[model samples]
Target: MNFKTKLLAYHAIAAAIAVIPMQSMASDVEIKYEKFPLTSPEAQQIWAAESNDATPLGEEKPWAMIAKVKVPGKKDLVVSQLFSSMHCGGIECPIKIMQEGLVISEGMACDAYEYHELSDDHEALMACDAIIPLDLK
Candidate 1:
């Protein structure tokens, strides 16, 4: 190829490489605590413990699944929250909802706390099509 054509080809390849990563990143969803306005005292406490240096925030365990249930014409969306245990003990280790940043739901075992009452039932949990284990540490 002539110099101009060769230069144009190199530019096209470079542009493609740059565009590909951005597209991949756009498709990827990252769950972070800050995304949801979880400001309750219990949530705050959990957040603090997670940040502490001495806390034993172990590797994320596969706790729950998220499924994109089909609803006509609307965007394909998955239920945002999934089950996660921080590996802490007692009250600290209760199942948490990682998406939306707040604990929208918890296991029935956490019924002692009023907020945990918002948790989903077994049928709801089973409906999820995808499971992602959370790594709290």
Candidate 2:
């Protein structure tokens, strides 16, 4: 209750705040492509779900996932993709990936994040998904 004690307490609180990480509700997600035969079990599962029919450009690299969908109460849906390579195009590239099947718990990166996802894309979640072209205009 003295000035000195109060100052020390404030400093301790500030230090604790600095060390603690900030948590927020994450909505969007993305990941980049990596070589297949992934080592992690999670990664392997994701890769297995990929479409075999995608084009080289789609299959080769830049795999991604870009879904904002979530099944309330249940965990958020998992998305993965490579739609362009599967030969679908237009606005948004029509990338797809396995969902629910690729289901991930809240608060984690998608498998495609291994590749690189500065922004969200649908490549990591599109395995076995139907390819539908969208209009850009």
Candidate 3:
């Protein structure tokens, strides 16, 4: 085919592809997790790496805090974020660790967790593979 004919064919194919939506690609995949209550007993006993009983959090390894987040507009819908270790920045928000212009758990892997939100406990269904020991202390 001539150069002009080839150019027209290429342009037509490009326009057709642009009009079609790619079903494989997701449009929205945003997930948010807020810090869980540290005062709760479950928060004190972390689910990540083990730390010595004598060594207080932040003294040795960073302290991992779980997040209790509920799906918007759904009172009964909730999920937990088993976040990596992060220091408590202050008393008001003891679990809010962004401080001193530094993040203790920076470059850490906070997985997209899936679990059964219970009234008094949580049951893990599936989660990111990065969860060490597949959810353990």
Candidate 4:
């Protein structure tokens, strides 16, 4: 083959090799968890059931505090605390960590939470402050 022809063929082969990885990486899909607002009926129903009530109590139903959370290398989660209900009062409200309409963790007390910078690719779920472990085991 001529010098120019060989050079052109080498470049073409290198370009094809580079494109392979990019194509494979593009095919990798990450499933994101669905988000629900605090006032949404879906969120309210979940909390109500967790609180052992058929429906939320008081005029202000869905009194739970909800926060969208994302941890590193983890699926998105919704953290909720029923701050006002017959089963709970004051800072003793129960904490629930949920994802995809399923409760991952619950029955922990949370006075509040510390949210990190979610906009800058930081972990959205930081720490649940003032949490007292209910299970002694």
> By lDDT, who's the top model here?
4
Between which residue pairs do clashes occur in model 1? 36-100, 60-134
The 10-residue segment of model 3 with minimum total lDDT is 128-137
Predicted structure 2, TM vs. truth = 0.29
Model 2: ten consecutive residues of lowest lDDT: 128-137
Model 1 Cα lDDT, one tens digit per residue, 20-136: 743433212222222222233434433444333323224533222222323233223233322234333444333344333444334323212222211121122221112223222
Q: Per-residue lDDT for 20-129 in model 3, tens only? A: 53222222222244444433445444432322222344443333344433323322222233332342222211222121222222222334333212221211222222
TM-score of every prediction relative to native: 0.22, 0.29, 0.23, 0.45
**How should the candidates be ordered by lDDT, best one leading?**
4, 2, 1, 3
lDDT of each: 0.33, 0.38, 0.32, 0.51
Q: Per TM-score, what order, best first? A: 4, 2, 3, 1
Where is model 1 more than 4 Å wrong at Cα? Answer: 28-137
Determine the backbone clash count of candidate 1: 2
RMSD of each: 14.5, 13.7, 13.5, 16.2
TM-score of 1: 0.22
lDDT of 2 by residue, 6-115 (tens): 99999999977754522111214433343332233544455544445444553554343444344333334434443334443432333333444643322222233333
The reply for model 3, stretches above 4 Å from the true place, is 1-31, 36-40, 45-49, 53-61, 68-137
Tens digit per residue, CA lDDT, model 4, 39-127:
56856666655544523445655465666654555566666666555656655566666777677667745444332112223222222
Reference-based TM-score, model 3: 0.23
Better of 3 and 4 by lDDT: 4
